[model samples]
Target: MTESQRPRILIVENEPQASEILTRWLEAEGHECVLVSDVDEACQQLEQDGFSALLADIVIAEKSGIELVAKAKEHDPDVAIILVAPSEDHHKVIKLLKMGAYGSVMKPLDQDEVTITVAHAVERRRLLLDSRQTQQHVKEEIQARIARMGEREEHTILRLVWAAECRDEATGDHIRRIGLYSATLAEALGWDQQQVDDIRLAATMHDIGKIGIADGILLRAERLTSEEFAVLRRHTEMGARILAGSEVPMLQMARDIALCHHERWDGSGYSQGLAAEEIPESGRIVAIVDVYDALSHPRVYRPAHPEEEVTAIMADGRDKHFDPRIFDCFLEVKSKFQHIRKEVVPEGVPS
Candidate 1:
C-alpha cells in the first residue's frame, strides 16, 4: 500500500463529541483514523492493528488518557502520541510527555491546529519506527552470527573431548551420554530450554582440560599422590581460562561449568573455593550430572556403579556435593533419568 494510505491516526477519547471533532480534523488532512473510547479498547486495537500516530483524550470511561498513551507506546514505541487535554489538564499533559508522549493539544481543539499537530506527530513516528526496525534487524543479525560461531566452537570443544576419549580407547558415546544426561538434569531442575541445551553442550566439553595433563597422569590406571592430584585439579582452572573472554552466554556458562563442576556444595572443593550459590547454576548442575555419568560408566580407574548405588550416593551427597533442590528434582524424576540413558546409550554401554 502507498505510504499516504497507511492508517496514520488512532483517537482514544471517551467523550464522543471531543473524539469526533479531533477525528474530523485529522480526516480533513487526509489521514486515516481508528477511534476507540477507552484504554482497554485502544490497547486491544493498537496490538491487533498497527497505527502511525495516536490522538487521545485525558479522560475515558474509567481509563486515563495518559495510560492509553503509555500502553499504545508499549505496543508500538514509534507511534506518535498526541494527548488531548483541557486547559486545566496542562499539568497532566506535561506528565504524559515525560512518560514518552510526543505532544499535547488543548481540548477546545482548533481544526487547523489539530491538523498541524498530527502531521508533525506522524512524521516523528515514522522516523522512530524506522529506527526501531533497523535496531531489531541488527540485533537478529548479531544473534545469528553468534549462533554460527557457537556451533563451530562447540565442534572444536567436542573434538577435544573425543581426543581424550580416544586416548582411553573409549567410544564417542562417553561425551554424548554425559551431554544428554546434563541436559536432563538441568530440565528437571526447572531450567529453560536455552539453559538446558547450554548445559548439554557445555558438559560434553568439561574434560577438555584433561588434555593438558600428561598421558601418564591421565591414563595412570592407579591412584595419584596428593601432589599429582593437585596438578590434575588445575585442569578446571585452565579450562576456565581457555573458555573465558567471550560475551556469549553459552560459552560463558561453559567456562563456569569447567571451573566449578568439581566444587563441593559445602565449600570444600575447587581452585577458587566458590561454594553453593557462588557457583553458577549451570556449573552446579553439570557437577552432579558429570559425577553420575562417571560412576555409572566403566571408567579407567573404576568399575561401573549400579543405578541404585548411583542414586544413593547422589542422595547422600545432597547439599554437599550438589544443589539440594536439584537433587530433589533428580530424585523425583529418577525413573526418567534411566529412560534417557536407555534412549541415548546402546545395550553395551553401562547405564
Candidate 2:
C-alpha cells in the first residue's frame, strides 16, 4: 500500500527492542504507528485515538494479553485486535480468538506478512462494525413500535373488561382485586418481576369473554339451569379464541387464563380439558384468585361468602380444582389478598 493509503496501528508491547523493530518496519511500510508499553496506556489511547487496528503482545508485564482483548471488545468489539505471540503459544493464540481477538501473528515477526494480515483484519472489522450498527438501530426502532402497540392493546382490554362488568352488579373492584390476588400468587410461586406484572395486567381481563353473553343471563337473580350453565361455560373457549394469534406475551397469558381458569387439576375442566401441569401456569394462577374474588364479592344473585367460607372452599379444591403447589403459595399470602381487594376499589364504589 502507498504511504497515504496505509492504515494506522497502535503497537502495545513492553519489550523496548521488539517495539522499536515493529514501529520502524511499520513506518517504512507507510503505516502510522503509536507505541505503548502498558495495558492502561494502550486502553486510554485506544479510547481517544482513531486507530485502524491494534497489535498487542499476549504477555505484557505479567498480564495476559487475552485479558486485554476481552476488555477491549467490551469497550468496542469493532476495534480489530491482533495478538503477537511465540509459535509454541498456540493454546494462547486459540484462546485470544475465542476472546474476540481479530487474529494472531507469530514471534518470528515477518514484517511483510504482518502488514498484509493487519490490512485484512482491519477491512473485516470495518464491515462487521457497519453491519452491527445497522442491526442495533433497526432493533431499537422495532422495539419502540411494539411498546406503543402493547400500550394500546392494554387500554382496549381494560375497556372491554369494564364493558363486560357492566352486565353484572359487581363493580370494577372485583376485576382489579382478582388481578392483585393473582399477581401475589405468582410472586409467591417464585415468578420474576416481569412475570408477576404480566399476571397482574392479564388477570384483569380473565372475564372479558363475558361480554359475549346476554345481559339477562349474566345478571339473572336466580340459579342458572343446567342448559344455561352449559352455555355460560363456553366463555373460557370464547376468551381464548378472541386473544389467539397475538404476538404479545401478556395478551397471550390473558388468553390462556381466560380459557383454562375454569379447568380442574383432576382433568375435569372444559374446552381441551387439559389438567395438572398441562394447564398453562398463568391459568392455574388465575383459577385460585378468580374463585377467591368471586366468593368474597357479591354477585347479582349470591351474596358474598364469608372469608372463612372462601378459605375453606379453596382448601377443598387444592388438588382437584387448582394446582396444589400454587394453592400452598396462596395460603401463605391469604391475608395480603384482602388488603389488595380493598386497595383496588373502583371509582364511585364503596370500600
Candidate 3:
C-alpha cells in the first residue's frame, strides 16, 4: 500500500529504542504512525486522533495495556488493537486476543512480520464494520416497509367505514370517535398499546352490520314495531357473519365487537345474550363506547341528549346493561368522550 492508502496507526512504547524500531518498521511499510511513549499520552492521542489501528505494549509505564485497548475501543469499536508481548507469555497472548486485541507482536519483533500482523488486523476490523453497516441498513428498510403497510391498512378501514355509513345514520366522524373512545377506555382497562390500537380500529365497525339491513328499517326516523325491531337485531349476527372467516387480527376483533356489542352485561341484551365475562372484552369495550356515542348524538329516531342525561342513562346500565369495571372506566373519561362529541358534532347539531 502507498503511504496515503495505509492505515493510520498509534504505537505505544515507553522505551525510546523500542518506539523507534516500531516507527521504522511501520514507516518503512508506508503505514502512517503516531508514536506515544506511555499509557497517559496514548490515551490522550486516542481521544484527539482517528487511528484505524493501535500497536500498544502489554505493559507501558507500569500501566495495563488492557486499559489503553479498552479506551481505544470506546473511541472506535472497529479500531484494531495489537498488543506487543514476549513469546513465552503465550497464555497472556491468548487471553488478550479473547479480550478483543487483534493480535500480538513478540519481543523479538521482525519488521516484515509486524507489518503483516497489522495489515491483517486492519482488514478484519474493516470487514466487521462493513457487516454492521449492512445490518443497520436492512433493519431501517424493514421498519419503513412495515410503516407503509400500516398506513395502507388504516386507509382501507376508514374507506370501508365510510361506505357503510353512506346509507345508514353513522358518520365518518362518528366511527372515528368510536375508535378514540374505545382506545381511551381500553387504556384505562390496562390493555397493551397494540391491543388498544386494535380496539380503536375494530370498534369503528360496531354498526357495520347495518350495511345489510333494508333501507326502510335502517333509515327510519320513527319508532319501530316489534317485527321491525326483531329484524333490526339481525344486524348484529349479520355483522359478525360478514366480518368472520378472516385471519386478519383487527378484523377478527371487529367481528367480536359487532356481534356482542348488543349483548348485555346481565345476559339480557340481544343476539347471543351473553352474560358478564361470557362476552369478549373487545365487545364489552365497544358496547360502552357505542351506546354512549349513540345516545349523546342524534339518532334517526331521537334527538341528541345533554351530557348529564347521557351519563345518567349510562350509569343506569352499569351492572345491568354494561360491564361494571368498563363502565367505571367510562365514567372517569366521560369528559374526553364529550370533547370528541363536540369536535365532530354534525353541521346543524348544536353543541
Candidate 4:
C-alpha cells in the first residue's frame, strides 16, 4: 500500500536463461521475485503465498502459460498477470488478454518496456486491494449504525409502553404477559427470530391508545353501556393512528397489532371487521393472547376466571373469535403460556 513497499512477483518461465534475466531485471528495480519453472510450481507457490504480479512465459513445458493466468486468478482474483511470449499476432494477444492476462511482453523482451508494464500492473493491483478494503470497512460501519438505531428505537417504544401502563396500575402485568405470550406463540408458529423479537416488543404497545382515552372510561369499575362501548372501540383506531407511518419494522408491526388485535375471525369484531386471514397475522396472534390473559387475570368488572373456565371460553371461540391455526398453536403451548403468566405476574397478585 505504501510507495516504499516492494511488490512480490511470481515469475513462471521454463527456460533458466529467460527466468534469470527477468528475475535480475525485476529484482534490480526493487521488486521481490519468486522464480518457478512450470504451471505446477507456479500454482503451488500461488496457493502457499500471496503475490502482486505473475509474469509467466507463453509456453511453459507442455502446458500453455495462459492456463497459469487463470490458476493465479483463482488463487487471488486481484493478482496481476503478464504473459511473456514470442508471438506478435494481434488476435493471439487479444485472446490472452481476454483470458485475464494483464499484458504480453515480446520474446526478445525489452528491459524498459517489461519494467514499465509490470510496474503499472502491480500498481493497479494495489489500488484494487485498497479499494476493496475501504468498501468492507464502510459496510461494517453501516451495519453497526443500523444496529444502534434499532436499539434506540426499541428503547423509545418500551418507554412509551410504560407511560401508557401508568394510566392503570392493574394493566402493567398484563402488558408484560402479552409480550411474552406473543413471542412464544410466534416462535412456535415458525416465525423467524426477527419477527419474534419485533412482535414481542410491539405486542406491549397494543393498548398504547388507552393513554389517549379519558380516565372515566378507562378506569370505570362498571360494565360500559352500548354507547360508551363504541367510544372504547375507538381506542383501536386511535392506537393505529399513533403508531402509523413509521419506517421502522417494529413500529409497523406494532401499528398492525394495535389496529387489528380486536378483530374477530368471523368478521364480527369492531373497527374494520376483517375476517380470517384478512387481518394481519400479528393482529390475529395478539388477539388470542390478549383475551386469554384478560380472562385469566382479575379486572375491575369481573373476577379472574378459573383456568378450566378460561380454557373452555377460549375453546368456544375457536373458529368464531380466533384464527383456527393460531388457536391450535395456542392450545399446543398453553402450558408455556401458563408458566410465563405465573413468572411475570406481579407478587401478591393472582393471575
Best-performing candidate as measured by TM-score:
3
Ranking of models by TM-score: 3, 4, 2, 1
> What's the lDDT for candidate 1?
0.77
Error of 1 at 138 (Å): 17
Encode model 1's per-residue lDDT on 202-263: one tens digit a residue.
88777667767777776777789989898889989888887899997877887888898888
Q: Residues 238-306, candidate 2, lDDT per residue (tens digit)? A: 888888889988889989998989888999987678999999999998888888888887765578899
- Model 1 CA deviation exceeding 4 Å by range: 1-157, 168-171, 347-351
Summarize candidate 4's per-residue lDDT along 1-351 as a digit string, tens digits.
Answer: 333378899998978889899999999999999998888988999898888888877767226645677788888998888878786655666677888888878888889989999999888988998898899999999999999997787667666687676777545566767888999999999999999999988999998877788888877778898888888898899999999999989889999999999999999997899999999999999999999998998776679999999989999999999999999999999999899877665544222
- Model 3 over residues 1-351: C-alpha lDDT tens digits? 112356789998877888899998888877788998788898899888777788887767225656776888888877888888878877877877887777788987878789899888777866786788889999999999998998787767867876876787677777888888998899888999998889888998888888889999988878899999999999999999999999988889999999999999999998988999999999999888888888888865569988899899889999999999999988998887777666654443211
**Top-lDDT candidate index:** 4
Residue 97, candidate 3: how far off, in angstroms?
A: 1.6
lDDT of model 1, residue 7: 53
Candidate 4: regions farther than 4 A off: 1-6, 87-91, 170-202, 221-230, 244-253, 292-313, 330-351
User: In terms of TM-score, how similar is model 3 to the real structure?
Assistant: 0.84
